[model samples]
Target: MSNFSSDGFDLDAISTQDNSDVIYEVGGGATVIQNEEPAMKEVEPSFNTSEHDQCEEFKKQGNEQFKIGNYLEAFDLYTEAIEACPSKFTGEEILRLKDEFDEKQRSEALQRSRLSEERRRKKEDEKKNGVSSSQPPESSKPQPFKTFELSQEDKNDKLAVYYCNRAATLQHMEKYNDALKDCDVSALLNPKYTKAFVRRSAAHERLEDTEAALKDAKAALELDPRNATIRKTVARLEKIEAERLEKLKEETMGKLKDLGNSLLGNFGLSLDNFQAVQDPKTGSYNIAFNQNK
Candidate 1:
């Protein structure tokens, strides 16, 4: 009724006056107050965006996208983020995104890998398993263990297999000494390897020697653990300790036999005990060869 619209009271002026009399008008008249600070948030940090920070940004963008419910895009973004983070950042906070993303990725990757591996393995396994196709055979995969018999090639192959398999088993058994020997033999047979080293590392773990174990593990991991046999070996070692002391002893004995054979071969397989008898005329001992046949 006081013509409120006509005056349109000076709100700004009122606010200014209120500001001045804030303390006075209240019980603490004319008192000074500390300034109110702005609330901090999970905002992007101000540090220079290095490759690591850039990766963080990618992860952040992914998270932001996820919040907006763009799941696919978020996933892709996170993938890029992880890839961008670089190997150096793997064990770092920068790589720290939602564990769900990683777990999802790991599950997906493992699933896909398993699927593909299964298919390929089946195809290969079918050859051995006799799960022939409906049609006649197009070709055949060479057997993994086509080794010869009682020959150098055979020994080499058997030794390799023995070492590789035994190394795997021993790793599970936590038999470091024996497992390491098998690994050494595996490598000797075929230097290009990851399985043996990886298994050997597991054996080292059983012995509670992390340093050497880590070294071997890293080396083996650096190689291919995707192999079915290698993966199986790893999996076996994961839950149990598999040792082959008997296998090792057999291998050692075989090697010793081979060594002895080689040495005897060099000497024409003869161990003749001979003493030099003096030749009276020349005052020199004649070489007497006592060949005990």
Candidate 2:
């Protein structure tokens, strides 16, 4: 401190000139920061809980409109709900979260496995000791395994419901293709959602794609086996698919016969000269060439 000059210690002696840099001391060293531009701030992604509440309100309004047969109004409300839903994480943050989630899942699985093994060993020991237990005690009973999920998955599930409801409205308006597109998004968002497949089946049926409709109906039935409506739909689709295939078979056979007759006419023969007999057991056709005819 004694070696320091008074001019160096004087605050007024420092130049507050017209330069674009500010000099500051850190660890007895001077550092210059440019004053021409402000430092950029780092922005963090945040979920707005209020927006999720707003989305739920919009969905309820849409349901009200749907029940009253106002399909267009319902579609608008559902679309608004979909738009109000918060965006999910993406990029590196999502990747990091996914890794953490996977690790947790693996740990839970290992824990469950060890617990199951321990229970089995305990039961075996009790049996050897002549324990008179007809069934596992309440505490030993297998508890339900809860499915874990990420926050984004929860938002996506809500968004899926909105898309599915909108798709139903589109179906009511006879916009089958548009409904199909919406159902596609709904199913992609939540594969376990059965209604999306049901709505898609209806749309495909309206578009006269019996095969596709049957497939989706069957899928819906599998997802909700106890649903009477889904079961009925699957049955109806199966019958329609069978009839369609039969009609297609007849048309194909007719076309083949015509082609055969056209080619055989060059030799003064016809398809009538070649009789097709079907084997009742095997459902195979035999073509016998009758030259005498």
Candidate 3:
């Protein structure tokens, strides 16, 4: 066996051994050691733990400020968190992180299934005894195995949340357009995040873009069907959208009538002289000329 050293294996010991040809150092500062097993390449960590922690601290401070209705202060802290967050990985680094994330997710799924099975067994035992246990149900939430080590995917999630929080702050500040921009970033970072959709819907509604607001509200409602607030928002937006469309139709028809009256003034005719009748089956309108009118 070869003994390990700071630089590498002890070359002096290898020279005395019968297997001298098995190991040798190459020139030009490049050392190649031949062993019974293949060497493993070290993967560099994708995120800086210190930076991730700092980001989390800032986010927590922001949340506290938000709870007290200090929206401007909260926005500033959330911005700091976003600035301090881990930069995204690219190329091979990102691919390796993704692989690790997928593996962890599979492990978490397996753990969740096992926990569910245990809960089911406990329920069956309680049923057999004809006695309900006072104990609370086991939480089905799947926790990642390690706490200290922050994965690249986790950092990404935190960054997304920071953006969403800032968006909420901006909404409170009455900066609807700026809020919409941050909401866009949050949604892009985490497409399944329901709050991003909700925030964006509110921004659109504030800007009087009822159609866009309704679309985003519906998206949020789709993601969280059981959320009473989101369901109510969807219903409210739908009503507002219908009323808005009716108002827009009335305005457009009024404009068209005004223009028609202008052109007909030279011919002693007005829009009132012609009546538009809608065919219910075809949903088409027919204009009837009535000189008596």
Candidate 4:
């Protein structure tokens, strides 16, 4: 052996030596130390937190605010929720599109039925004339009928609930017309929701639409017959509607009277020139023109 120092060898310096190109023989194969960087993992997006979750959280916060009668705060939170998850608030648009699609489908179905009937009539006529039917030359293949499908997002009940809640808040804030619009959206989204109907009725009442209020109240009653509040609302709305009709009738009669007076004034005559004598037995009135001043 060569002469070796009694002190420890310089192990730290040897260990710290750069081994970029160092190779070691192991099992008759060279194992090289690579200076390459370590492979990085491809990070996948986390599905744990999403817009839907944010929307739900906002909705919960809104509900809490609503319960405490902080309608403005509730409205803001609900609005934020709608912004976060627009799909949750697409009830009105979904209903409108569905109605449009249904109308189109009905129209197409009727058209097809009429076309088939016309073809059958033509075939009968041709048979009577002893003429064989000629097949029309086909052009490009017929395009497939387009199908309308409502995505899960569009049909969400939570959207209707949010609309209904917002409508209630609007009603509290005395924004009757806006409340009515939101109520309409909520009703369109979930027709069977009694609370929506009730809220809409209240909105209609505030807007002096007694007829509409009555209608909505009656609808709510129909949905929940045992709900005394709705029954009372129906009664109140009916009374209001009656009063409204009476007031309208009086206003119409007043207008007509004014018009008649104006026309009579133009003719150098007036309602004062007319006299009526009522006969109680006959329940009739005999009119006469007064020549006296």
Residue 62 in candidate 1, Cα distance off native in Å: 50
- List, residue by residue over 88-193, the lDDT tens digit for candidate 4: 3354575577678878987887787777778778879999999988777333333346645554334434455667667656655767788777777666655666
Q: In candidate 3, list every pair of residues with a backbone clash.
A: none
**lDDT (CA) per prediction:** 0.45, 0.67, 0.67, 0.63
Taking all chains together, each candidate's TM-score versus the true structure is 0.24, 0.59, 0.58, 0.54
Ranking by lDDT: 2, 3, 4, 1
Candidate 3 — what's its lDDT? 0.67
lDDT of 1 by residue, 186-235 (tens): 55444444445655665666575655655665566457544444444444
Query: Candidate 1 at residue 292, lDDT?
Result: 67
lDDT measured at residue 188 in model 2 versus the true structure, 0 to 100: 58
Worst 10 residues of 2 by lDDT: 3-12
- Give the TM-score (vs. native) of candidate 2: 0.59
* TM-score pick, better of 3 and 4: 3
Misplaced by over 4 Å in model 4 are 1-56, 80-154, 272-293
Arrange candidates, best TM-score first.
2, 3, 4, 1
Candidate 2 residues lying further than 4 Å off, grouped into runs, are 1-48, 88-155, 276-287
**1-293, model 2: which lDDT tens digit per residue?**
11111111111122345442222211122222223332664232344779877987897798667656677898999899887876464223433555676688778878977988887888899899998668755464554544434443333556777887787677777788988888776765666667678768777877999899888888877877776766777787789899999999999999998999899999999978889889999999999989988
lDDT of prediction 2: 0.67
